[model samples]
Structure formats: structure tokens, C-alpha cells
Target: MRTLVIGDIHGGYKALLQVLERANVTKEDTLIFLGDYVDGWSQSAETIQYLIELSEKQQCIFIKGNHDVWCHEWLLNPEIENHIWFRNGGKETITSYLTNNFDTIAHLEFYKTLKNYYVDKKNRLFIHAGFSSMKGPANEVYLTNYRWDRTLWEMAIVMDKRVKKHSSLYPNRLKLYSEIYIGHTPTLHYDTDVPMQGINVWNIDTGAAFTGKLTILDIDTKEFWQSDPLPNLYPDEKGRN
Candidate 1:
């Protein structure tokens, strides 16, 4: 029973499938997805439906992302316009529903069921983004931070490497978990298409929404697998590039 942490899918259902096959994933494996599952590619709605189906027979944990929050709100009240979301890949997501068979209510429920974050038996943290409190996510004052915060990752990047984990200078947040796995900030921004480790935090989002590929990393082995770039999988689509 392996635990696999997946990165931001960003509606690339094709990329999702390829990585699963490439990783040789099995039903016994636990899939902890870090969200941004919808938006970017041309199959946003299809991706959700597929996952909803996949979860029926596979062990899956879904984390809510910023994009997912926007998508859910729009589904609940389509008349309310979120121009920011629309400008950033939301338009493509809506078009995807039109192109596919969308069960509006079921999809909305699926979104509503997503967790803000998850802590495993090993005390490892799997979150879409980051939390603010030194006390950790459960005690976070602003839940939106769980989906939008970048400071956690920023802190990890800027931390002085010389500061040991046992040192007082070590971040409290880093000290809270045995290992932190996240996906809101793509590793591509840091100039790598593979997973990057900052302190003890591992960023698995390989920019599947844009030029990079989708990735799945085994939590135990630290080994990983990737699909072709989103553009290659959806050659006719721009995929938020």
C-alpha cells in the first residue's frame, strides 16, 4: 500500500492518465491529489467526472485549491461573475462543461467535499497551498490561506541552510511536520520541471497547467513519475500557456 502524492492537474485529464500509467499505480495505492484539478485544459469537466468515478474504486484524497473554490462558487451561482478567475483559465473551464456532459449538481457536491488539507498517519502534511499559523492548518485563522498562501513556500526557500532543524532559527511550520507535500506553487517557476525540495517541504506541482508536465511522487521512496508536457498531450490547446 504505497502513498502517492499528485501535483496540480489543472484539467489535463490526459496528463493525469499518462502519469498514473507511467507510475504503474495500483488500486491499493493511495492517491493524495493537491488540487487545481479543474481549469486550463479543454477537459475540465471531463477530468472531474473521471476522478469522481475513479475514486469509487481507488483510494483517493482530494484537497481543495484556489481555482477549485472559484469553480465551486460559480457552479452554485453562475450569474455571479468572477472576472479574475475568468481571466485566468476559468473561461476554458466553463467551455469544457459545454463540450461535455456535465452533471452540475454532482460536480458541485464533489467540489464541496474536497478537504482543505490532510495529515497522514506519519504526521506528514498534504495541502494544496499553505497555512499561516505556527500552530498549523487546523488552527489557521484564515482558511483561504490554505488555498492561496505562498509565504510558507517562500519561507522555505529563504531559510538559511546553515540553520539546523534542531536550531531555534528553524521555522515552526517546518518543525510541525515530518515532511510537507504541497502543489499550489509550480516547480516550473523555480526553473525546474520536476519536484523541488525546499528545506523539508516538497513542491510537486510541475506546471501541468502550462509548459510543464504532470507528476506523481511516491511519499516513501521519494521516487516520481511524469507525463509529457500538457501541450504535448493536448497539442491543439494552449493550456494556459
Candidate 2:
């Protein structure tokens, strides 16, 4: 059974469908979504619903992204008011729900069930964002900080650089995992014909919410597949839904 690790969908349902169709994913294949399943497009509700259906038919792992966290926060406490969420394509998500008259309850339930990370015995780690290496109980710190702490992302990048440089021989560093798949940072030249290799940290977020393609990486083979023709939902800078 092949495992396909997908990146931040960000409500690009059309792009997502195209990628899945191109990949010809089967029910036996395990799909690990790297999160940001909602917000930043016209079809947030539809995208979440599709994921829920996909999970029922296959081994699916969903991790929480910062945008997903914002969605949860908006659901639980809409009164709290998050300007950043509104500015960052969340306005469209809100409008979609409102247009459907809060029809996203089931989709919201799907997001609520997601975990922050998944690890396999084969040394494959999947997370929505970066992890923390705070020398405490390893899993505890990694999970808590990776999902909820932005500060940890900054620190993890620094630590990741150091780890990449010096941890080739150290089993302690290597023992953590052989490879990690993540999203959140969007590659500007995502659809360019550039070949990427070397580090096993595969970042598949093609930034579909921002005129980019959707991406999927086959974890075992490290073969990347992406949707053709980048989407352009947000054409203006006014942040209008």
C-alpha cells in the first residue's frame, strides 16, 4: 500500500480533485493530509466534506494547521474576533458558511478530529508545521509546540538547519525519524520545472489559496505529483470575499 502525503489544501477543491485524479489514488493507499483544509477559497465547505468522505474509504491522517486552528477558534469563539483570519482568505470561508447558513457543522467536526502529528515505525513523520526539540519528553513537546506554538516553528527551523548539518551520524538525531513531511510555508515558484531533492523534508504546500498548484508526494518513493495550472481565486489585494 502506498502512502501519499498531501500538503495544505486551503479549500482548493478543484485543484485537489485534479491532483487526486492525476495520482489515481486507490482505497488501499494511505493519505496523510498536512492540513489547512479550510479557509482561503470559495469552497471551504466542499473541501472539508470531501476530506470527510475520503477518510471513510481510506487510511487517512489529518493534522491540524494554523488556519485550521483559527477555524476552530472562530467556531468556538467567533466573538473573540481575529483580524488576521479575516485578512488571510478566511473571509471567503466565513462567507461560504454564511451563504450555506452554517452548513459546515459536519466539516467542522472533521477538522476537530485531526491530530497534530503522525509517526510510523518506518521513520516517516508527518506534521502540519515544524516541531520542537526541547529535550523534554520528546513526543509531548513535539506535539504541543508543533501544533499550537508559532514560536516553536521559528526555533524548529534553526534547530532543523543545525540538525541537517551535524546530525548525520548521531543516532539520537537520526532516531527521531529518517524523513519528515510538512506544510504551511508556501513555495513561491511551486509549479516551476525545478527539481528538488537531498533533504527528506518534503514541503508540498503549493499555495493554492494564493495562485498556486496543489501538490502530493508519495512518501515511500518520494515522487511528487501536482495539479496543473495554478488557481487564482484571490486576484485583488483588498481581501474581499
Candidate 3:
């Protein structure tokens, strides 16, 4: 029973599928998606549908990302204007929905149903972004505050940075239950730095939407697998023209 922790998909369904095939994931394997499942790429709708089906077939845990929350808000109440989604690859997601003529209500409900954070039986934590407050170690953070509170988000960022610096100096400052798995911040490497724990909090977002590799981490062995690089779906102004 291998537990696979996947980073942000960001609508790169092709890359995701390739990674899954490479991993040879099965029903016995639990998949924890760290959020940002949609947006950025052109296949947002397709990605969501794939995830929906995957969730039904396997042991899957879907966490809400900042982009997911934005999409939910816009889909449920578009009249109530918000820029968070639009600024962060929301336009691509909206375009995908409109192009596919998807049922808005159904999609919105799916997004609403997603959990903001997840804690495993081993007490390992997973979130889209960083946590608000972690009590003992990376795994014992308050899920509610980590997911929904704005103040906690601000403090978490600060603490995370501090921990990252300290961890480098004192390699074994603390060891919580297991470790926290997160996405949202794309990194060139599979395991980036976090305060206090050095590489305690693993970041798997390999920036697939930016034509980068898609990453998946094997929970038991802590091994990482990646898909072949793809073209950036949403290139910068220089590449757009």
C-alpha cells in the first residue's frame, strides 16, 4: 500500500497521466493531491473530470488550493467580483469551462466539497499552501486555522521562513509525527527548503503549467518521479506574441 503524494497538477492532465502511468499507481495506493488541480493550462476542465473519476476509483484525498478556492467563489457567485482567481491562472480555467459548456453548478459543488487540509492516520499533514500554526512539529498544525484563517497564513509564512534558516544550522531541531506535504509554490527541485526542518516540508510542485516537469513523491521511500517536460501552456508576454 504505497501512498503517493502528488504536487499541483495545474491542468496539465497529459503530464499527470504520464506520471501516473510511470508510477503504476493502484487502488491500494492512496493518492494525496496537494491542490492547484485546475487552472494555468488549457485542460482545466479535463483535469477536474479526471480527478473526479480518480477520486471515485481509488483512495484519494483532494485538498483545496488558493486557486481552487478562487474558482469556487467565482463559479458559485461570479457577480461578486474577485481578482484572486483571475490573477492566478483563473482566466484559463474559466475559458476551459465555457469552452466545454460544463454545468456550472455541478463544478462549483465539486470545488466546494474539497477539503482545505488533510491529516493522515500517521498524523502527516497535507495542504495546498503553507499552514497557519504548527504546534509540536510540521504535522500537528491546526487544520482549520491552517486552511481558512488569513492571520494564520501570514504567521505561517514567517515561521516557515524562520524554520528554514534555523533547520540548516541545527539539522535536528525537531521532528513532528511525520511531515507536511504542500504545493502552491513551484520549485525547480523536488524537495525545497523550509525553516526549522531543512527539507521537512516537501514541495512537489514542479511547475508543469510552465512547461516544466510534473512531480510525484513516494510516501514510504520518499522517492520522487517526474514526467517529461512539456511546453508552457501560459507563457509570459514575450512568448505569447
Q: Each prediction's Cα RMSD?
A: 0.9, 4.1, 5.6
**Each prediction's TM-score against the native?**
0.98, 0.80, 0.76
lDDT of each: 0.93, 0.69, 0.67
- Stretches off by above 4 angstroms in model 2 are 101-104, 134-144, 148-175, 189-198, 232-241
Which candidate comes out best when scored by TM-score?
Answer: 1
What lDDT score is found at residue 179 in candidate 3? 70
Model 1: worst 10 consecutive residues (lDDT sum) = 96-105
lDDT for model 3 comes to: 0.67
Count of backbone clashes for each model? 0, 0, 5
lDDT digits (tens) for residues 175-208 of candidate 3: 4436767676656433432211224566667766
Off by over 4 Å in 3: 134-175, 189-197, 232-241
Query: Across residues 19-132, which tens digit of lDDT does each residue of candidate 2 receive?
Result: 898898999999999888878767776787788888889999998888888887777676777889888878887776666654457766876788878887786777776665
Q: Assess the local accuracy of residue 75 in candidate 3 as a C-alpha lDDT between 0 and 100.
A: 78
The prediction achieving the highest lDDT against the true structure is 1
lDDT of 1 by residue, 24-69 (tens): 9999999999999988998889899989988999999999999999
Model 3 scores worst on lDDT over the 10 consecutive residues at 232-241
